[model samples]
Structures are given as C-alpha cells and as structure tokens.
Target: MSYESITLATIAEKTSISRPSIYHYYDKKESVFVDLIIQEYREWGEQMGPLLERRCSQEQF
Candidate 1:
C-alpha cells in the first residue's frame, strides 16, 4: 500500500490507530517516515552485504 506523504490525520484514518498513539511512537510524521526509510536501508544493506563480500573475494582470487 503506497501511502504518499501523508498528514497525521490521514495516517490515523488509514491505520485505524488513534492519532495520539501514533504520536506516542513518533513525535512527528517526518520522524515516522525517516524511521521507515532508515529501516529499509538497513535491511537492504544486510541483504546485499554477503553478495558484496563474495564479489570482493572473487576479485582477489
């Protein structure tokens, strides 16, 4: 579900979670987006790390 840059009220409506609860987790909507982006980057790095390592080993061989 690609939810575009959304306001807190929109997120609350989509999630069915109270706006206060969202606020409890994230101070602002930007913070929530940033957290998600960082998490995605970390996951991508983890998935690619082994591939990169193997490439380096092949180059050294």
Candidate 2:
C-alpha cells in the first residue's frame, strides 16, 4: 500500500500494540514513520547480517 494508506492506527492494529503505547514513543505520525522505517530496517539487517559479511558475486547478491 502507499504511504498515504498507512496510519498510526494501522500500525497499532498490525502490531497489536495500543495507540497510546505508540504515541508514548512518538509525538506525531511522522515520528512513527521514522521509527517504523528504522525498526524494520534494523530487523532486516539483523536477519541478513551474515550475508553482509560474506563475499559473493554481484549476480548472487
């Protein structure tokens, strides 16, 4: 979905976390965007951490 289609409520629902809990860490929806991006990126990086340390052909990469 497009960024415009996503909302704090959407995130809260998907994560099963309350809106109030999310708001506690974020002052605004944009802040939620930043946190979500960073959190997902970090999780992705962690899952792909080993691959990052390995050297492979560009095609394989």
Instruction: TM-score each candidate.
Output: 0.69, 0.57
Query: In order, what lDDT does every prediction score?
Result: 0.81, 0.84
Clash count in backbone of candidate 2: 0
Give the alpha carbon lDDT tens digit for every residue of 1-61 in model 1: 4456677777788889998888788877888789889999999999988787774665663
TM-score result, candidate 1:
0.69
Where does the lowest 10-residue lDDT sum fall in candidate 2?
A: 22-31
Clashing pairs in 2: none
- C-alpha lDDT (0 to 100) for residue 35 of candidate 1: 88
> What is the Cα-based lDDT of residue 4 in candidate 2?
86
lDDT of prediction 1: 0.81
Candidate 2, 21: how far from true, in Å?
3.4
